[model samples]
Target chain A: MNIDPVKALEGKVERLGKDLKALDSRLENAQTDAAHEQLGLSNQLKDTTRKLGRTNDRVTELAESVHRLERLLVALNRKVRAGETRKADFGNWPEIEKKELAKIFQGQEAYSRKTFTPQEAKDTRKAIAEYDRRAHEAIEAAESLTHLPANAESLWRKHYKQWHAITDKHRPEVPDDDTHAKDTAAKSAGNEAIKRTRQQIRARIEDAVANDLLFPAWFENAMGPAAPPGRADDWLYTATDVVLYRLLHDVTSPADALGPAPAEDGHRKTLYDRLVSECAEYRRP
Target chain B: MAADPFARLADRQQSLRTALRALQAAGPGSPDFPALLTTTNDEVEAVMQARRDVEAARLTTPNRAIAAGTTAAALIVAVGWFDAWSLLSLLVAVATAASVLVDPAGRRLWEPRARTTVITAALAATLLTPLLHGWATLITAAGIAWWAWRTQR
Candidate 1:
């Protein structure tokens, strides 16, 4: 053992060197494997970034389409709402106009009467002017809402013109002996004109039906069906006129058609009653 | 046979007038005047009720012949227009008539202006059909007619 110490030491050193060489080779192999794994991870990271970018682009495109769809829906909703509003306005116009005309008529009637004092006459004229202004406003409001039937507006204008003419022609303040006579004549003439106008309207309705231009559904409903060829009743014509007046004026109540003053005439009272009943019947569901 | 409501009403009115005259002649101071006045008022009321009954009866009983005739006439006119013009024209005419028939009060047809527009357009297309000839013209006419019909409905 004493003789082999140097050789043994040398052999141990050589074995230690060989072991160090093997550990160094293993470290190199591990670094190479780590480098290959790092490259693969880097490629995966790039692929993930690319997919995220595409996802972001697709999300942006979807958002833009949704925005466009929202705008279209908003526009369509607005159009439908506008149409409904217009229809509602048109439906409400007749009653509003009727109220305004009633006020005007009351004023006209007050001024037309012989019982009014000079001061009362003046007050009535002022009131009539105010009523006229209000009627104009109502008409303007209706016109702004939607286009009304031409005949409806024209008939109103014609009635107003006649009423204005009658009011202007008779000044009760004038201390003339014939002032009462003139007023009476003017009043009678106005009544006659109104009667003629009503007849004309009725004739127009008949003509429109005859020519197949228009059908008077309301009229037919109010007045029983048309009479037989030779069995035509007189009451039918009167009833037709009354119904037409109510329809044209949108008069639903007897007071509106016959005025607040009680009718002393039986025939007039009957007519008004019939009108009220017919209008009610027609309006029933 | 049913009693004539009109004749009954007239008789009641005559009786009321006679009682009124008698009451006037007797004067308000007379003891019988109150009874006469009451009787007269009763007669007036009776007459009014009779008149109302007659009117109610008349209003309910419509002449079926006239209604049928009107509808027939309208159909005939529509059919005649169809023969003379295009189907669109006939459609417009019939639709207009049907609207009146369906809603006699014109309550359902809220847009009179739209109705007028459709009717005018349909008429124009029908009228222009005879004046124009060619595939393009026919297509245009057809388009206009279809547009009118679609818009109206």
Candidate 2:
């Protein structure tokens, strides 16, 4: 019995479209997951910026306080050096010193009306000085976090190389272009449809992963439950790695145009660098 | 200005125009070229709008301190002529003070070089009493206000 080739081809194309439509749903789910993760990161960055602004204000206040304290101390020392007071008055000088120190803590608006015992002023100054020191340390830490985007990029690169190796394992070599040209059967509409469908799936997956729109479900399904203390970063490594590997593995021969191949390690590094650079917009300036 | 986002958007706009032109030249028959060209044009417009938004966001509203500073500078230079606070001088001060205040960005309206020039002119004007020194200061203040307005644009 002779089979109608075009009719059979049409049936296959219809089935292929249905499969791709299903894959599209999964891609959407992944995209949603990535978007949520990005939102969390963005919120965290904003929080850090707010904290930085407050810290800057505190630093300014501390500097101002120190200046005021120095002036007060100089005035007190000048009065003492003038020898206008008797030695008997020296015992009560500490009380005066305490009052002056306390006045420094009270803001200028309320300073004249609000009375502070010498003891309270001394204690407040000590406490505020300690707070200022801690604030400086926090500012240092926040400054260091400016490098967080670079760290994320490096972590992603490491996972991508691992995924690439795993996916490449035991895979059949793709047939060469000359061989494909000779095999007319391989160039049929069915093959072309399959190629186009595959390209679309690959692109959607890459877009979802590259833009960090991939949901945790994409990673959890592949990597199992993430190790405890699961941050968005944990899934990020796996989701992007999977997408990158699939993208590289599914490309047509002409698309393998990564220029000349290097040593295996060098080739992976080149690809990693290229992929990281492509996603530079997501990274810090 | 060094980290201005609008400047970057403007640069993107130039590149986008070049790309859109190339795609448009590909003609309508080519599959995807029409869609690509349309998308590129949309992106260019988006960038242009964003640049405009950024410019609008940073638009310098008149600042009271700037107006006050201008009047103070005017008075400082006018001190030698009429009564330092003569009716005419004070009126000029009040009127100029009522004028728009210019906020600082990039080089300041009262930049060091401008400050030195104004101070030198005022000092020289002091030698010619009658407090005609008002013109030099008035002119200097006007120059600064002009510089600031230009910078904001």
Candidate 3:
């Protein structure tokens, strides 16, 4: 088949050549009779000016539409995040949408399959401080999730339970407040704090993608509450808060829970398993 | 053919491990672990006690300071506080608390905590001294007597 573009280019070039010849002839004739050709040149200049104005107007219209759309998307996310109630907020989300909401939902499931053995747990505890620090840096690099959006358009659906969750995860776990009186509570608090860092990393990822808010809740949730000293009947509610937040995230849509850890070999452990183990006492359901 | 419970248990346990392997690898096939679970409680408890004893034998005493502080606490309550020596008693109690402050073991037991506990006790004890004239003396005397008995014994 013949190429339309090449033929069109040839035709345009021929037309342009003819026009140039005409213009050249006119110019020559004008040199002899200059008054006749001046009006035609002015008319051509006006036509070009009108066409440029139309193109400029179209460009400006499209730019304005893009700017308006970007603002609308940001605002819609904030509204959706805000509308969530305690039970209803996370639980009611549709399946496919919630899955697509954050990378943690999609990315980390392979971690669970690792041989999540006691040996791994024992070994990990020693280096956990460093391990968690790296995880934190990784999370910060991912995205900013401050204003939080739900899957739907509801403005009243926002939820702050995730913030509460971080608080609960770091509660003083062992050395029961009464009997372990001789035991150092600072040690207990410190142990739980390390554990909490692992748990919060997931929630923060969720928040950053779902909300535009920086990790305010996650930061506040770090461990080491009042160490070594407590009144009667005091449990570290901080751990519970973190647990509840995770449970809330998890229970809502299994799809919505924090993603699994990266697979070490091929086992079925997850980030959720780590969170559950680290913040053991606080899990609600 | 087996000499004892462990030998019998080990054979049974071996079978159970095989079942555990199957369960962990895939799903419930021939369940051997469940049967062991029903039978092993008593044996487990006995084994756990034996394990604790072994651990206890190997375990060393905690830090020296903690032992010293406990000793001092026991002594202050037992000896120095007795015989109605109220001022002496106060001195002993202060000394005991101070030892905990200086000693690392005591730090482990009571450093961060008992902050409010000690403060409240001091405040309450201080406030009650004047009102508890005869009653207070009697109570103080009784405490001293108890300390004397504890220390002397």
lDDT, candidate 1, A93-183, per-residue tens: 2323444434434444534455645666668667656644543443233222122222243443343333233222322232344555656
Q: In model 3, which regions exceed 4 Å deviation? A: A1-285, B1-33, B39-47, B58-60, B63-69, B76-153
Q: At residue A237, give the lDDT of candidate 2.
A: 45
Q: After superposition, how far is residue A118 of candidate 2 from its true place, in Å?
A: 99
Question: Candidate 2 vs candidate 3: which has greater TM-score?
Answer: 2
Model 2 misses residue A280 by how many Å?
A: 86
| Model 3: chain B TM-score relative to the native chain B | 0.25
What's the ranking of the predictions by TM-score, best on top?
Answer: 1, 2, 3
What lDDT does candidate 1 reach at residue A169? 32
Q: List the residue pairs that clash in candidate 2.
A: A30-A214, A30-A215, A31-A213, A33-A215, A34-A213, B81-B131
What is candidate 1's lDDT per residue for B1-153, written digit by digit as tens? 238865665565566556555655664435564465456446544544554444433422232222233345435544554444444444444454344334332211123333333334433443444343122234434544654453454
Clashing pairs in 1: A225-B62
Isolated chain A TM-score, each model: 0.29, 0.24, 0.19
Tell me the docking grade of candidate 2. incorrect
Tell me the tens digit of each residue's lDDT in model 2 across A175-275.
34343333334334334433443444445544443433322332323332222233435334433443433334332233222223444554345555554
Ranking of models by lDDT: 1, 2, 3
| Fraction of native A-B contacts kept, per candidate | 0.00, 0.00, 0.00
Per-candidate DockQ values are 0.01, 0.00, 0.01
